[model samples]
Target: MSEKALVHIIEDDAFLSKALSRLLGAAGYRTLVYGTANDFLTQLATLESGCILLDMNLPGINGMELHAQLRMQANRMPLIYLTGEGSIALSVQAIKNGAEDFLTKPVQKDALLNAIAHAFDQFQIDDLQHHRQQELKRRLGSLTVREKEVFDLLILGLLNKQIAYQLGNAERTVKAHRHSVMEKMCANSLAELVLMATELGLLDKTS
Candidate 1:
């Protein structure tokens, strides 16, 4: 995980955009600037995990519309909206639609920096959780047919003997499978295995 998250500034006002970039740069953040939404979208696929500072009023494809497109595509980058002549209704709508923060022009330096810090923190947390889920899926995929069966029953609160009886296997064989399940899943105990199963959505299906 990178300590300095990128701050993408999408504003048509060159002066404000430049000032924001300098401010963030001085605050130990990496930044990319775009004069329009289209400019930002051009490199969307290659953009790393970060947050966006979007200007509400742009020449074309405004901030709100771009945000809708980003959400539709499942983009996870947190966005903060900046507007010169913002309305209460617009602010409410932006927040309701998942904007990190909405700020009127002439935003205080502290407020802007605080919002950026908060957004970066959230992005890091979300990125970590996404990676954890991916790793769990990978571990689950490594299980064998028998090991998977044992794992399912184990998380369902089945004992080794009961699992062996249900699967028509010897108790010793079931025990071996159980051990393999614990090893392959990297689970420390039965409780942790159950928690992993729940996170992977297996518990609901089995229950």
Candidate 2:
């Protein structure tokens, strides 16, 4: 219902584009229509978080290719392929390439709406993940160099003495650094610290 959940319509056919916009608008969705893929790409950053209703056949970049490009660019916008009957194979490929959903040409209203609803649901999940990652990055950024070193070792299941030996520091100094790491990361215990490290990709980076 909010403008932030806009349905971006990229269809070549003027009539169908307008009709889709009207339909979505009547259902309490905001929409922005474009006649070509290029137009949509040009204004992509300005668009709010939402789903894309993309016709599989566009003038410049075809829907399949555009979908691939979007993925390559790390675009998280959920895509619903509005393809023709003959483009079933392409639609499958689109889904395989990370499209959220698809619909054949002459799409049923209920089916389209349902797909849009599902896409928005996915967007919510993705948005939450993105924000969580950002928060983790901020927390990581708050760590001092020594605290980060201590954190890396702590998550590696190291004892304070072992970490002190590895970092060429006293055990008491290592303990202080470890405490700082846990506090900055907002971790309550060693197990929670390890989980936070795992979630922040710190484990993978060290491994």
Candidate 3:
């Protein structure tokens, strides 16, 4: 439903690309057309929020190879594969690699629009998670080194006395650090602190 959302079309066929662009534009969407996978790759980092409609048979890098590169680059945009001669194996691999959908050539208008809508909806959800992670990182940054140490131990189900023993600090000092950790992390309960730690991948780092 976002007017600013742009659909990226990476089809080598000039006529089909133009027609697809027109179709998306008319349906209240913006579009970027690339004649080659390399062209799209060049602008991948700067590409705005939206999904990708990639032709499976590009001239150089090809669609699946491009998808792999995007994965390596950590581009989480939704992708829909368009293939003129889609095989079961190819479609299966595409889906396994996290493609939103696979459509045969001469795609239906309604189908294409619906796929785009679904992909954009997913983009919104991903964007929200991304922002939440960023905020968590910011809050984590606000902690002092000692406070971070206290936070790490506290989330590990450690008592203040246990943490003080491990850190060679007095119990009262450990208690003060824990209080600062809770305030800076904006967590009211141990459960809330643990959830933030999980969201920020701090739990993974500790484990």
Name the Cα RMSD for model 3.
2.0
Best by lDDT: 1
Q: What TM-score fits each model?
A: 0.86, 0.90, 0.89
lDDT tens digits, residues 111-139, model 3?
99998889888778888999999988999
Compared with the true structure, all predictions reach lDDT values of 0.92, 0.87, 0.91
Q: Candidate 1's C-alpha lDDT?
A: 0.92
Q: What is the C-alpha lDDT profile of model 2 across 2-51, one tens digit per residue?
A: 54478899999999999999999898898999999999888878777678
lDDT of 2 at 48: 78
Q: Which lDDT value does model 3 have at 100?
A: 91
Task: Report RMSD (Å) for each prediction in the order shown.
Answer: 2.4, 2.0, 2.0
Report lDDT (Cα) of residue 128, candidate 1.
88
Expressed as tens digits, the lDDT of each residue in 12-117 for candidate 1 is 9999999999999999899999999999998999987688999999988999999999999989899999999899999999999989899999999999999988
Q: Per TM-score, what order, best first?
A: 2, 3, 1
lDDT of 3 at 87: 87
